[model samples]
Target: MKKVIVLISTYNGENFIREQMDSILMQQDVEIEIHVSDDNSRDNTVNIIKSEYSDKISNLNINKIGTGAAAKNFLQQLMRLSESDTFDYVALSDQDDIWNPRKMIAAVEALEKSNSKMYASNLTIWNNSDNSTQLFKKDFPQKKYDYLFEGGSAGCTYVLTRDIVLELQQIIKNIDYSEWPNFSHDWLLYFLVRNLNEKVFIDGNPYINYRIHDQNVHGHMNTLSVKMIKERTKLFFNGWYHHHALHYKKLLQSNSLEYKILDNFTKSYFSRMGVLLKYNFQLMRDNKKFLMFFFFTMINFKTPKDV
Candidate 1:
């Protein structure tokens, strides 16, 4: 009898929005309501939702910023929801994915049956062009850096407990999304949940059918193992690595209690800002992941002279 609300952020998703909505309405073991925050879709995305699943929707907010900021869109959706305590849990949904009938049931059961404050499950990625399906990733992640370098899991599969939802509302008031435009909403939440020692449940079974296409924002899911070592190396060497680091730092700074706790992690995690910000390969010796520091930048015979 758990009450759950699915927060969906939609763009021009008319092609599959209706089919997805049907699957959402088919979820079991929970009372469900859908609240969509659409980023001013020019197509019939809103009309499709209204016409196809009017009974399934709870709230709809239309935004005109047209920034196509999915993270900000969802963050705002969560903020709007934080004002009330009507629901027991909240799940994230992408407008285009088809949900398994038991998605909500498994998520709620996993959290209630255990001490996990948040829930994320594996999904089968469906390729549109060729119509192929594959596991999002073969392994279940356990490390802190895994959450960073490799996103812990798809954000769309998250079912957050009430406490997690409350903290999100509190911390976001001080966070500026512009600071890290590409910083992932899922990774940010996963980082805090782990660092705060909040119990997290990661179900191994695939629960949703995640869609992958040329236009997907985070479409790196071609294989279970991230075999793109070259791309990963670029991520480390490029300023993106450090930029992401700063993104976490800024969020941590916003919550004093959280920041104080994060201060307890290996100091190297906090001290790499200089190398990251400067993209200084010569300072690789200063970082714990010297190879990564080197690979991310200054990968040649000699490192940059420290300035």
Candidate 2:
């Protein structure tokens, strides 16, 4: 049996943690070892895992000294796993999602069949309030610069080969965490993997139920609501995207085309015109999002804020 290490980051997830744990433990055709990092929950999340799952999970490792940020917690565990070589694959999990019985095995099979180092899949988004479910498709044909704008999928559905994990470990080591912007870990990972020229396979089929609730750190934004528009506008005008763009430029080869385009884009609005003219439609998944990217890049002239 192939060994898989599952890393889960938790934050006050007492309500559904048990269900999530049970689903993970029930995975088929893989030897599972779970590593959980809890962000100092004030609830019984830590207690529940220890009392109920310790015996059930033979190799369970729970660390409760998290910095309260989900990204930091996940990255910290990944950094630690860099020193170990005990698993064939590494998967990221959320504290609230339920996995199918074949999630891990399916990921393993897909990776082997496609000869890909990294994998991400679409998911079924289950809304807690209305009890409605929708298939969130992220299997669009990847464009040239999609990683610069968004992640392929949620991190919960991500599965990485051991080689990819080690590559990420090296990249993580060179990063100055204090200077790093608050980018989603999954997005950053996707960016790094793509920048390394690694082949990533995005599975159209979903193997997990992504539960949406009030306490979710980041939820679905498929529907364009007034609230979503306002939030996106705030992030745009406040220089969040610009900051990420500028920071990411430093991590790329200076002479590469990606670096040049990103460098030009980070300059004044006039400098960005060339990039917009040449790669406008190529930067996003679809023309609709490309229009939004164009509008934001055209109107935003404020200097990127210091991190």
Candidate 3:
């Protein structure tokens, strides 16, 4: 039996933590350890955990920090513990969601059976108001290339082997997966692992109940007004454009054909060409004002400058 570490990241989640914990505690197979990284919640979260669970849980406090920053800090703490020993796997958890009893066992079996570095499963999306639930399964392309380009996967579904988790720890120390442009840490992890050609697999099991409510940052953003949509669309375009350019720029700076190919081929789409080109061009201009300056300095005055 593999010893798995359940790494749950949370903040102000008093309303649903007990349900999530009870589900986890009820798992029948394999040995499990629980680690809670609390984002310095202002409610009865910590106190409740202490009173109910006692020493069965370990907690990390990230008082007054962003979710991304809190996750990074908690992972760093995990790294410190890792110097002495290793856990068979690291499973990402959200405070508000409830895990099915078989989640951990099934994920472990899937990882061991396939020798995969990472695994993500389908989830049951639960609506907070009407008690409606839907299974969120992805119909990804059979080819890895297609999956990389069509990159929308659920984060709370991730499970990583020791080696990949450690490698991610190193990569995140430098790149900080949480801060990647409105992108979920799961998306960054998926893209990074895929970029490295790591062995990743997805299973068709709805072992998690993804609770949706108004307070969720990402969930709420999806229902904004048309005007808000336009503004956020512009922001998303700008952010993604800069992110891709920086990614390719790193590849070029490193002079690696492997990364360059991955970057280029992953983004080669005809329909999105015009929009991506505009974004990439603006990204370049913003980063390399000197190049823009030199062009004007070298060329003869063409038309009256916008003065």
Candidate 4:
């Protein structure tokens, strides 16, 4: 049996933590050891894990990051795991999502079959309010610069080989967290893997139940919804996107063609439009999203500035 280490970052997730943990424990055909980091949950999340799952988990740390920084919580786990060599694969987990019994095994098999270092899969979105379920497709063909704009999928569905995890550990060590903007860990992982020219396999099948609720930090089922569009527009205009692009460029420290293209796109509004025209703005795999990206670039008036 292959050993897998699962890292879970929790906030105030008392309502669904049991269900999620149960699903993880039920994963088949892989040896499982869980590591959990809590961000000062005011609820019974920590208590439940300790009283119920103490024997099942490998380690648990109650890091009181009162600011609810999920990305930091996850990254800290990666840094800790860098010291160990017991696991063949590392997977990220959210406190609220339920994994399928075959999630880990399927990911491991896919990675081995495709000879890829990183893996991400589509998910089933479960809306708590309506009690509805929908398949969220993220298996679109990989675009040339998709990682520059969006993550391949949610972080919960990501599985990484041990070598990839070690590489990410080194990258994290070099990153200055104080200056690091609030970027999602999933997107950063995808960017690093693709930017470094590592092979990644995106599975078309859904293997996790992604719950959407009132307390969701970043959950959206409809990409074309007005709410999502407005949120994306706000981020684009507020220099969030530009700031990330520039920061990633600095981290790469490369004169490669891809980085150069990203640099040109971040230079100015006109240069961004030029890049969009050059590629027909196909940075996004979905056609509608590409159109939206074009619209956001066209109306972005603020010049790129160091944040």
Candidate 5:
């Protein structure tokens, strides 16, 4: 039996915590332990976790940290753990999703079959507000820089092998805080894996009921219409896109040749029609508008090319 440790981050999930735990405890064909970090939830999240799952779980650790975003909470949990052979795989969980009984089994099987270090799956997005549901199904295109602009694997669906868990632990041991992105540990992990040239497997099977409520962190469903594209572009220039673009502009300067292409592309596309010459641009220099459209669309939304 494979041993898997799930790292869950909770803020205020009191209502759904018990149901989520029940679903996880019902998982088949694995020895599962849960380690949750509660970010100072003002609700009864911690009490409910203790009452429902404290005795059921093989290993349960519920920590109360400062109030913060999910990224910080997850990263802290990862950084604090030591390298160990205690578990064969480490999976990520959210306070709100219900895992299918076969989710862990399928993730482990996919990693073995692909000979990869990490695994993730398409999720069933359950919009609670509208009572609508859809499958977030897409195959992994296995391209470079897909992780940077497009977060390849949704964090909650992630399950990393022992090798990858060790690699990330080592990164934390020697990470440069100044170079860290202020958000999205999922995207940063993708960058690290791609840089290492490790094979990543993302299954198309929907394995979890991903809840979409008003409190969703990043998994909002949006139609890919042209008007939505404009809205996404506006959002791109507004926050994460601009910040990460500038971040990559500096990071790519010292990275591989493919990244230099990304850097030049960024500068030229952000320009109107003149700054192309200023950027010493080659390879995707022309078609600035189309490039912008593609870049923004990919960065802002998901494509088959994404992870």
Candidate 6:
């Protein structure tokens, strides 16, 4: 029996929303459902989620929006409380993470034994000032053409698939919020469900106690310095190259043969250079080591996995 809906979203999560609502009401079996959308959190985090989820919660009030507009207004109030109801899954909580009572039963047995419509797990980075734990093992790269430049897909350890959240609510009702790309809302639902291949990657440990406070943004972009890491690495690679050139210009306006061979070999290797464009046409391009690791990752190179 599947009917999960742990969708959360908040702002001032009053001291780890009651240990993430008692590890999700001490999950034992299933039939879960808890939605809380509070962007107006002037602190008590909406009176501790209305004194602890006032009867299986369902609150929304995107105070002064923006955080992907309070996650597209909490996915349009969870698609209007699932209209005439139906919920095989729709998790994406993070009011100060805690999960892992088999994190929604291992993301519903890896999205019902993977045909891959969406699933995510393997996270445990809980450092709350020294109560350490760092697991982060989400391995997926067995390469199905490297899932067309894999980004997003870790919105607080995901698990979606009410038909991929109604096909991301019809791609967020034809998105164009000023031509998008402010990035977030799990990288725009991991760039439209991994470019419609529907993505899935579960391994284990869904417990993500990642409440390393100071109202984390990108979890303290590696304890900044070196000139705020060269101005936050050129504003995080110019907002990841404007959301990877707006998802590779919507995969070359949907003509997609892997973005027409990665946009004709990244526009013929940035119009030629020396050494046969450095070791033969960008190493005979076929995801040439992720386009020379995204060309020293869009110029602002400096690693330690660039935090």
What residue pairs clash in candidate 6, if any at all?
none
Per-residue error at 17 for model 3, in Å?
1.0
- Tell me the tens digit of each residue's lDDT in model 3 across 177-225: 4444444465566666766677677787688888878656454333324
- Model 5, span 30-135: residue lDDT tens: 9988888888888998888788677765444455557367877787777756665488988888888899999999999999998998887678888777877887
For residues 1-307, what per-residue lDDT tens digits would candidate 6 score against the true structure?
Answer: 6778777777777988888877886765777777777766677878867776787664445556544455565565555554456678777777777776767777777777776777766566665776766665555443544443443335777777787787677667666544454445654665567677666665555456666656765554323236445655565455553344444555345476555544443343242222224333333223544455456444533321110
1-307 per-residue lDDT for model 4 (tens digits) = 9999999999999999999999999999999989999999999999999999999998999885553578878888888985456999999999998899999999999999999999999999988888888888888888888888788888889999998899888888887655666567888889999887888899999999899888887786343368776776677777767777877787765777667777888887788888888886458777777887788778776785666
Q: Which one wins on lDDT?
A: 4
The TM-scores, one per candidate, come to 0.79, 0.93, 0.74, 0.95, 0.80, 0.29
Tell me the deviation in Å of residue 56 in model 3.
Answer: 1.6
TM-score of candidate 2 relative to the true fold:
0.93
Question: What would the TM-score be for candidate 1 when compared with the true structure?
Answer: 0.79
User: What is the full ranking by lDDT, best candidate first?
Assistant: 4, 2, 1, 5, 3, 6
Looking at model 4, residue 240 earns an lDDT score of 68
lDDT of each: 0.70, 0.83, 0.61, 0.85, 0.68, 0.60
Off by more than 4 A, model 1: 138-141, 144-150, 220-237, 253-307
lDDT of 5 at 218: 61
Model 2: per-residue Cα lDDT over 1-307, one tens digit each: 9999999888889999999999999999999989888778889998898999887654444554557578878888888885456899999999998999999999999999999888999999888888888888888888888888678788888899998898899888887655666667878888899888887899999999899888876674543357668777777787766677787887999999888888887787787777888887777766787788788777777767656
Score candidate 5 by TM-score against the native.
Answer: 0.80
- Which candidate's TM-score is highest? 4
lDDT of 3 at 214: 66
Error of 3 at 104 (Å): 0.9
Off by over 4 Å in 6: 5-18, 21-23, 26-86, 92-127, 130-154, 157-159, 165-189, 192-194, 197-210, 213-258, 261-307
TM-score comparison, 5 vs 6, better candidate: 5
Off by over 4 Å in 2: 58-65, 220-224
Which 10 successive residues of model 4 have the least lDDT summed?
A: 220-229
